[model samples]
Target chain A: MIRALFPVLAILAVWVLLADGALACAVCSGGDDDVKVKDSYVAATIFMSLLPLCVVGGGFLFLRHRYRATPDE
Target chain B: MTSRTTSLRVVTNPRPPVVPSAVLGMLLFLFTELMLFAGLISAHSIARAGALLGWPPPGQPRLPLEETALNTAALLLSGALLIVAQRVFARDKRRTKPWLTASIALGAFFVIFQGVEWVGLIREGLTLTSSTHGGFFYLIIGIHALHAVAALIVLGMNWLRLHRGILAQSTFAAGQVFWYFVVGVWPILYWRVYG
Candidate 1:
């Protein structure tokens, strides 16, 4: 297990080094803009991510409720 | 009184049909696909937020927002026509064919228009590798186009099967479910990508 972890750790180290460039946002980097671009991005990201779950999960729950409400025939 | 005798009987009531399993299965599949698109949209949101320049990234061709709205209307109308087709299928099976044809035509029109728009954008030097905006544009819309094409093919197949009197209700419903996902998902995409 220790030997197996070595390669994983090496890959993680590489990713850690490269991750900074990948994560940096343009708005946060430089800009005198009206709306805080970083905040907008964060808001948009959260909304987009949650939307699918809400839609899909809500549909499933609704269906289940309906199923239970239905009387045995 | 001598001996008493008893009789046992089992009674069963027939249940009405609920949503067909095929349609439900398709719905589940679409749910997953919705998440897939969500991931793409999230990426776009992050990219657009970070974009230092006005989005479309300095000199990238502006997306034809107004023109695409017309196309979006066409797709929505197609969905409406599909509902009509389903209704007509129940009342007058023969009449449903024309409505189905119309729906398919509208869908194809949307796809073709998108292709035209893509050509225009490419001519304007907005290729996939051009910029983050260009790359995401293609990735998101390209995935949608792929789903639309597949859904169209399924709709076409369903149309053929209907004419032959071999189309099962479950299959027909499944096709409708897929089309609904394609149609329903576009407005969100339009707002995100275009707006």
Candidate 2:
């Protein structure tokens, strides 16, 4: 298992090291003094990223529960 | 020999679905629709944030916050009535008609009121091409309106089926899910756009 995880761990370490390089685009970065714009970008990014996962994950969990509750024919 | 024969027999019955296919299909569709709205709302947020002169821009006519609030109440009440109708349906499907009719009427009222509001806004120089504020307003709210109309149509059809004594539970459930989505998403839009 450790050997199998070695590449995955290495990739994660590299990703962490290079994280700051993944900066926002010019439009998203907005004006340096405009806190509201920066905040909105962050909020919107988080919302867009998490919404699908929440919805799809919730749906999956509900279905799984229902399926488990159902009696076997 | 009897035990051996029983073991060899094939099981013909399949496990039933956790959710009805119709309801499941509607849920899946709503998921995609939810994502679409999310994207639009996200874009609107970013645009509003980037507006140097502040949201609604300097010269754009203000959104009808009060009037639209009333309309929002009407839409919410319609959703509530639908839940009531569903409950009534469980007892006596026939008894659900009045509640269902009321729900549909309120929903229709919402749409009509929105249309009137749109006309007023357009006359006030909030046309689609006038400004970014106007554009986002129309685009986000217009897409929502389209969804509302479509959901209302679905509910209307289900109501008719109920009237004709042919409505299935699954069908009504599916329509309910869609109508709820339309109703549920509105408050968020109102807050993000109008508030």
The DockQ leader among the candidates is: 2
DockQ of every predicted complex: 0.24, 0.57
Off by over 4 Å in 1: A1-37, A65-71, B1-17
Instruction: Give one digit per residue, the lDDT tens place, for model 1 in B85-186.
Output: 988887877778999999999999999999999999999999999999999999999999999999999999999999998888789889999999999999
**Candidate 1 B-chain TM-score:** 0.91
User: Which is the leading candidate under lDDT?
Assistant: 2
Task: Residues B1-195, candidate 2: write the lDDT tens digits.
Answer: 355444566768877778999999999999999999998898888788778787788778999999999999999999999999999999999899999999999999999999999999999989999988898899999999999999999999998899899999999999999999999999999999998
**Cα lDDT, model 2, residue B25:** 95
- For model 1, the DockQ equals 0.24
Top model by TM-score, which number? 2
